[model samples]
Target: MLKRICIILICFIALLANPLQAKDIIFYGGDKNSYNHQILHHALSYQQHTNYLVKTYTGYAPKQRAYLNLSNQEEIDVVFGGATIEREQLNHAIRIPLLKGLNGWRIPLVNKKNGNIFKNLSSTEEFKQLLAGQFHLWSDVVVLQSNNIRVHKATNVKGMYQMLHKGRFDYFPRSILEVWSDMERHKQLDIMVEQHTLIHYPSAYYFYVNYQDVRLIKDITSGLESAIKDGSFDKLFNQHYGEQINKVKQTLRKTYQLTNPHLPPKTPLSRKELWLDLNMHPTT
Candidate 1:
């Protein structure tokens, strides 16, 4: 009886040390600065006493797609952010809106004939035939096809943009922030540029995990619960980023992020509106 008890005790201690059982896991993320890292850091900090560890796979969005697809194949334990009506069909992700923020990409380059995306914009229906798992650039046809709007598989965003500028495609999608950043490099190109709404995205973000790891998923949910109750989560969010919620109804006047390289005439964003609009951007 004593011998049997000794064996059971050893097994119990072993279980406690093993990360697979105690907690320590790798997560896949789109990028290091993304909101995924924020949520993961918050969860681990809250559960550090419990010995849980969370790691991330940081890379670009294109690479992230490939990594996520692989995880889904094995359905292993993984944590990430990003969601869409189409991706939901796979059903391996647990849908939880970690936070809400503004996220939209406009096509800056357009067909020479259309003049500019901001002007000749037609409709999203103009695209719907994507070439799965294949693409090289960001072009009008690439966006239409990749989003299943038209028909083709492009390799990456840079490639698509090249095609757009070459007039091979009508437009290429880019976030306001991204475009704001990119325009800095192509200042002279603005002469042939215009923003398009076909690439508009209202809301896009989520905290999710693999389907095969049910136990890990529960741990994540529980960790978040604990963080929320103690105000740890909000505290962390505000610490890294100032208070996001604000009361500004007078004017959308935003603070001049003079940082915007391609700013047409240097419009000033009200200081009050600066942080407020950023609340929508979320740094990530």
Candidate 2:
């Protein structure tokens, strides 16, 4: 009995000393290879406690369905998206702009033939006259429309590229971080990243969890905050985007600033460290 009691005590002590078992978290939406996906992994690595094993769900879910899954905590443990009032109502947003507000800096993707159209722009009014192509469900659609810019909507990404190539829209404004990869994907379509125009607005992307998932909410928020403090967050961001930033700086582009009426009121826009500074650009 003494030997058995000693063995039991040893096992209990070992359990107490070991770190808590990492939670198996199923991330239901977002591409596993995308920048946002990489940032998610980086953030989770900084967890102070309650380690997480984030596995991407292979099956696809539309944005609305993903929102529903996260809200219900059914299968999906987390989802990332642009900060919108409606989405925040359904789930708890971590509120760190995953892209550091770079998503708002759009560079147009134009048919190679019409590339010259963007080479010269005199005024924001002329820029607004061009029809912009965007996914109908994207928050950018309303933002562009609210700013008096005409927009043509596509139902899907592939369709947006097709529409742009077919002249169904004047130009497709793609985020600076995304436009290069998107360019490679549709290389067969003869589209070119516009050389000299940058559209600016305020936008933020965030990871969201079920409102009831207070543990995950706390873990992600704290992890990201810690990463930011240790400078790891900026390091990771530069690793992924430094090349693109250099390219944007090689040539001066006409900066057309627009208003984002949809930007959440709670966005930490005042946090200088959390955003990329495009204010150095000379406005046309």
Candidate 3:
């Protein structure tokens, strides 16, 4: 009888310890190697502050069309992507810039033989003469086309790289954080980074929750804000991206600023503490 009582007591204690164990939050994104996976893991790790445990599932959806379809179909509870007005209309955004506007700073990926193609390029008009590659559904396509820059649209990212290699486009502009790793990963293509130019605009990457997931939205927003307030967010950012940020600072690249017409009105641009300024060295 005593053993039976002890078993019951132990089971009760276990239940008490994990009262919300059944509440699982699903974070879906591309494969483990993708930046989306890193952001999902970092963002979901903070869910200990709420009554949920996060389980990540990598989906087959490509970068261009992942967020809307995944969230709308209830296949994913959370996703990370570049924030735009249309995207916010489709889902709820956490509004904290994940990369702190660095997504807007683009460096070109060009064939090794033509590495100096942008060396003497001085104006946006001259830049416009070169055709660039962009994803068909990406906000960057709109931004580039609006600036009078000719863009060749591709549905898949890997295919875009292949097209650039085949000279279907003059250059492929990729984020500074992404360009180096892409070049290394696709080394067989013999692409090199263009050292002379930087394409600048205002862009933000944010965590988005499904439209009906109010509890999740609240938890994520609170957790992210807490992480920011305590400096853990900055610490994590530097831990992953310090090398790239430092590389950009050391390079004498000429920057050309462009207006991002797709920027949402509610972007937290005034939150100075939430962003990393490339001009001001960020502390790890």
Q: Which number leads on lDDT?
A: 2
CA lDDT scores, all candidates in order = 0.45, 0.84, 0.77
**TM match of model 3 to true structure:** 0.76
* Candidates 1 and 2 compared by lDDT, better number: 2
- Candidate 2 TM-score, C-alpha based: 0.84
lDDT of 3 by residue, 1-284 (tens): 99999999999999788675346666665455555555555555666544565566655666546676656755677777788787888888889998888888888999877888888876767878899999998778989988889999999987987888888888898998899999898988967888877888788988878778787777777777777777877777787788898898887877766778899999988988766665321111
Best by TM-score: 2
Encode model 1's per-residue lDDT on 1-284: one tens digit a residue. 99999999999998777645355565665344655676766665555445655655444345356446545643224645445444444434443344422233233444445553333323333232212122544233333343445433456755554555555554444444454456556544422344223233333344556566566566677776677678676565555433222211121321111122221222222322211233222111
Which has the better TM-score: candidate 2, or candidate 3? 2
- Between 2 and 3, whose lDDT is larger? 2
Clash number for candidate 3: 0
- Residue range 149-268, candidate 2, lDDT tens digits: 999888897788888888888899888888889999889996899988888898888998998888778878888898899998888888878898877878778888998988778999
Query: What would you estimate as the lDDT of candidate 3?
Result: 0.77
- Model 1 alpha-carbon drift over 4 Å, by segment: 1-22, 30-34, 57-76, 84-92, 98-107, 110-157, 188-204, 222-284
